[model samples]
Target: MSTLKNEVTAYLGNSSRIAEDWANYINHQDWTLEETIENLRQMNADEDVMVQVLMLDTMQGISTKSSEKTPDDYTVKYDGYYALNKMLSTFGNSENGSDVCITNSFTNYINGILSIGFAVKVQVTGVDGAREERERNG
Candidate 1:
């Protein structure tokens, strides 16, 4: 009976170690948004994909709101706008690029999804600027 009890204890200990290793491996896996979207596409069909996209976008908005302002905000915003402008010019160039219709569609799609108000919130921190902008715009 003692030998059997010892064997059972050893088995349980090994099982616990295996579970811990599995959890660690899962935690260390690098995940990306594109891979996640592809996985969802494989798992779900039709309207489920749209639902997942909307859910992700909403979660992004919430996560963006949970962060406090840092000094790097301006740098990031400048880089983003600069890259966007470059892309627009490259893709929309009349002489050697795609037509305006495609560019306009892409622009509208980007504008529809991007929250300019959220950008303003992140870039404008002071109470005075926020109040003035609200008063002047609204």
Candidate 2:
């Protein structure tokens, strides 16, 4: 059990790092769906993993609605973070040739999350294409 816990911790750490890296990479660039897909591929990530992360991130925004004034709120937030961490574990293992669909889904998901006013300051910058996609579709 201890070993498993340690493994999980390590995995989470790695995922967090990757997420941060991706966020930073897109911080100043105009990201298109194709460009985002290319960046993920450069990171050795698979399509499914990319889609999963996008989905989890979208969900995380929704989960933030819990009042942070209570301990339960913290717990909920932790669980959402954990789910994102778990999704990161599947990165780089998804099937190829689905980047287009995955990118579209990711854009739609992000837009939906934004529409709820849940991720105003959580924008993934530097992806111009992604921003355009969201604007066009939203």
After superposition on all C-alphas, the RMSD of every candidate to the true structure, in Å, is 22.6, 15.3
Q: Which stretches of candidate 2 lie over 4 Å from their true place?
A: 45-138
TM-score, one value per model: 0.23, 0.37
Clash counts per candidate, in order, are: 0, 12
Q: For residues 1-99, what per-residue lDDT tens digits would candidate 2 score against the true structure? A: 999999967865665455455555544466644454445456645332322223223332122122324424311221344433343323323343112
lDDT of 1 by residue, 1-138 (tens): 999999967855653443334323322344333333344345333331121111111212111111134422211121234444343334333343112111111111111242211010111112332211100000
Clashes of 2: 12
Q: Which pairs of residues have clashing backbones in candidate 1?
A: none
lDDT of each: 0.26, 0.33
| Candidate 2 accuracy as TM-score | 0.37
